[model samples]
Target: MLQQSARDFLNRQAPVKHLRSLRDAGGSKGFSREVWAEMSALGWPAMAIPEEYDGLGFGFTGMGIVLQETGRTLTPCPLLSSAMMAAAAIVHAGDDAQKSTLLPGIASGEALVTLAFDEHTHHRPGQVAATAKRTAGGFCISGHKRFVLDGAMSDQLIVSARTDDRVPDGRGISLFIVPATASGITITPCQVLDTHVLADITLDDVRLPAAALLGAENEGLAILEYALDAGRIGQSAELLGVALEAFERSIAYLKERKQFGVPIGSFQALQHRAAVLFGELELCKSLVLNALHRLDSDANEIAATASMTKAKVVETASKATAEAIQWHGGIGMTDDFDIGFFYKRARILETMLGDRYFHLDRFARQHGY
Candidate 1:
């Protein structure tokens, strides 16, 4: 009931026009400090932090609600990258001192944080090539990270780097919290299909203090996996919302659109299609909710649940958005129509954190075939 109330409230706050206005005003950057401030005032960015850290402590469930609502309207914001993924990395791995220094700023919305993990075109966290060599006083990180969400606008970045070459895959990786404006760091902005901005970052011998290490030396892979599980759940919720919105729009279009002197919804074929999409949307929601509950619980199947949820959401949302476009006819293909935006976002989210095929493979491996 609490989740429902929060979802309804956010829906009211982020209607279609508000989202469209934000998209029009904010282009490549695609974020509004003023809007973020208002959200901060509402305590959104801090929703998952523990209450002891001056946050609302609503956990992933609360974050999921906010993301779902944002996805419904395609609201231009950094809530996913800053609040969900980056905050997860900190909460999971940051030491007490590091948490004390970072969590407060993140919870209060004074600092926007994002993860810089992917070094190549792929989404494999275990394939890290960025190296961070230890120095007398600190570490010098040198390498490139691609597809860093909101990297250009984020105030702090939690970067993953290889600290030991011997352990190759993931055992050698470490995470560091570095200021986005740190010396030797350069960010180049790139645009995604939904007009969201991602960054390709270059770290040319970027130096940081010894205190910058997020977790124990060479122990970041576990933290990254933990963060990815939570991130996948949060993303699935957003995709669920996107599909829900598209399905609703398709239903309304069916009712209003006319063919053969009757509302198109009266047609048996369209009705069946809507029904099938509705079922898929509800199933997606169930998977997301179940995954969220697993993460928040003592369940040992969190990884598998998360993979299942992510895979189902990727498939369901993409199909729902495609059906929405088909049901809406030619107008859906135009930029003026809102359905196209949802479709585009679905396409992008389908790949982030691994696609349907990737998650399916992970899920299978988690279950031992």
Candidate 2:
């Protein structure tokens, strides 16, 4: 299913020319509405949601398969935001009312959503700069959230903020759902290494009613924990896409590009590196699939497995992309080619949820090491 989707997309939207066109607009950061339409038409948004809610109702494994193809093409759509981050949050933490209202729209692609939880403080939702102070009607939000994925384009924004400062940090956080066009909200686009659009969102006395609060007030971090596991899995899934692509490119170059009458691929040292990269990719893939299966089955080891998968996928994929570029020589550096794009995208995807080091520590702690 994954390869077929990728093959179809390759023939249609992900050809070298199509990717180049997105690159020409700007490298790395792009959100193409037309391309988004193609993805929507393909029913990707519905894959992980329940069929009763008008979704495909498949598990993360199915979504991973589709997203592998998405990563292969590197289409500038909001897979993490629309399909995983925001969607999974709804699925895992939302109430029946919230599900009935939000899930259908999300699955159908009429609404685009993204989560904004980062406040520049390291690893604590309790470190929220944004605060929701109680008002007569409901709650008012104030402060900035940086590096929100696809912030400018998403139809709805799910925000995490502190409701109290006296408690331990993550304990006082709360999640809220607000509209993009809501009064007192500003989404400013930030230029970063990847051409992927990121936003600095400022909510100046943005009022959200009682119903806007997701789960319970001042207990959002627990809900965030659920999102984090799913988010890490999603990120791993994305890296798996880059790893496969990088390996394929390395192989192709070795077979064709010549050195002294023989293909450079014939070089012993180069062949060894390709073998290592392929092995790393396979090992990384095993962990992610294990994590995904554990989560879908509600297994006891899901959390620890997620940390394991996150560390391996990010680390191995970084090495994979770098090797692909180095072996391809200078052509990999050019904007006209996909290797550099894959490299940059791999780097961007690597740091999203938890870096390898972060997961390494978490994995050890969870295992009582």
Candidate 3:
């Protein structure tokens, strides 16, 4: 029922044409507030949140279902940034008081939050250079972050900064909840190829109260990694949806398009390509499901599972979208066709969180390879 409802709602309210409209309007918001509000009413943002925090406590599997639907239609929203990623961070590390204060708003969709961990051109969660020096009253953070998802629009940011003067690795890291409007913080919007908005943020001695610190100081690397794994799994679910939709569209097109007075799908070469993609997508479905299940169960091997799922899903989605465009021929390359949108979205998602290479390396390290 959850999957069906999500699919129905997304198809009706936010089809591929919705993305086209948003891109054509050049909206800096990148997503619709009204549509997001509707989703909020339906408890999408609350899927994985616990019931104690005014949420449904549906868990990651339920959340993945909604994400998959959103990906199928290319819907733009903060479900990943605020609801899944930041929420996971808070749940994993935040004190009870912090959870009580933050989770309710996130559950209600009244507040938007995003994680800011990447400081370089690539997605390196542990190589943070941001510094949060202790002050008389609180802490003063100074650093620059790139590719912050929903950074400009979020109400609060879970900023990761180094607390000790150690090397720029996983240790000495801490997470802080910084207000988006905090003084000395600058956010500049950057538009990517997929018509999505990411922010380049600069913090020049941004001051925060002692209460703003999330989790124990200098012990945030674990929290950060936990949140990132959740985000990667959620992204894998979305990528799966993107690939499935693209594959379905391509198959439908192949049947309709004719070559030599017969359906192009009847050609053996095209059939072979479609068959290969179908099998790959099926395998991805199982991987995504397994990852989501592990997260919900708090399995011991979550790190490895998350990395493996992300790596496989990223690769599969890339192939599915590329083949989608190829099968559609010239029309797929044109901006006027919706198929091109899936290809662009796949490219962006491929690099987000951890790319194929990043996940492959992480998965190997996790397994002591």
Candidate 4:
């Protein structure tokens, strides 16, 4: 029921053409505010948030369902950044007062929050160079963040910085919730290949109250990891949706397009390729489902499962999109075709949160390899 409802809603309100319209218009917002408000009314932003904080408390699996539907339509929204990553961090580490103050806004879609952790071009969460030094009033943060999802339009930013004298060490990390409009903060939009907008943020002597600390200073790595794992699983679910949609569209094209009075799908080679993709997509579905379930149930296994799911899904989605374009031959490569949109989206998702290589390495390390 949840899946159907989400699919129906996204199909009606935010189909692939919605993304094209937003892209063509050169919209700074990157997504539709009206559509996002409707999503809020449907309680999507509150899916994984706790009930006590004016949320649905549905769990990660439920949120994953909604995210998968979004992927199917190539919907441009902050559901992954604000609703999943930033919300998970606050839920896992925020104090009672903080949760009470911040969560309700997120649930209502009145506030947009995103996690800013990456300092380099790669996905090294531990190699933070951002500094947060103690001040008489509270703390002052100074650093730059790149590839911040939804950073340009975010209402709040959950930034990770070094609080102790541990350069590039994970032990001294801390997270702080800072208003995007705060003094000495600059957000610059970066144009990427996909329809989404990423931002480069500069924090120069940005001061905040002591209460802004998300968790214990120098003890926030665990909380960050927990939230990242959840995000990785959520991304995996979205990738699954992308692969499915691309594969489905390619299959339909095969059945419709013909050569010499016969459908291309009747060719043995094309059939074999489709069969392989079908099997791999099926496996990806199981892996993503298991990862989502583990996030809701088994904490100890979440890290490993998240990595495995992310790595596998990334690879499969990459192949699926590539194959989709290949199967479509000439038309798929054209910008006018919707198949190219799936490919572009899949490519961008491949690098977000951690790519295949990053997750594969993490998975091996987690298993003592």
TM-score of every model versus the real structure = 0.95, 0.94, 0.98, 0.98
- Misplaced by over 4 Å in model 3 are none
- The lDDT of model 2 is 0.80
Q: Which one wins by TM-score: 1 or 2?
A: 1
lDDT of 1 by residue, 160-189 (tens): 999999975759899999999999999998
In terms of lDDT, the poorest run of 10 residues in model 4 is 165-174
Descending-lDDT candidate ranking: 3, 4, 1, 2
Model 4 lDDT tens row, 193-272: 97689999999999999999999999877888988898999999998999999999999999999997999999999999
| Residue-level lDDT for 162 in candidate 4 | 90
Clashes of 1: 0
Per residue, candidate 2 scores C-alpha lDDT tens digits across 1-369 of 655865687558755456567656764446677777777788888878888888987877777776666677666678668777788888877888888899888887878888888778344444687889988888999988888888888889999988887887568889998898999998888755656788889999999888888888888887776777777887788788878877897899999999799999999999999988888888987887777777677833567888888889988989988989899998888876778878887877777666788889989989899
Report the Cα lDDT for candidate 3.
0.92
Instruction: Give the clash count for each candidate.
Output: 0, 5, 0, 0
In Å, residue 47's CA in model 4 sits off its true spot by: 0.6
The number of residue pairs in model 3 that clash at the backbone is: 0
- Report the lDDT tens digits of candidate 3 across residue range 109-190: 9899999989988888888888999999999999999999988889999999999866546679899999999999999999
lDDT at position 346, candidate 2: 84
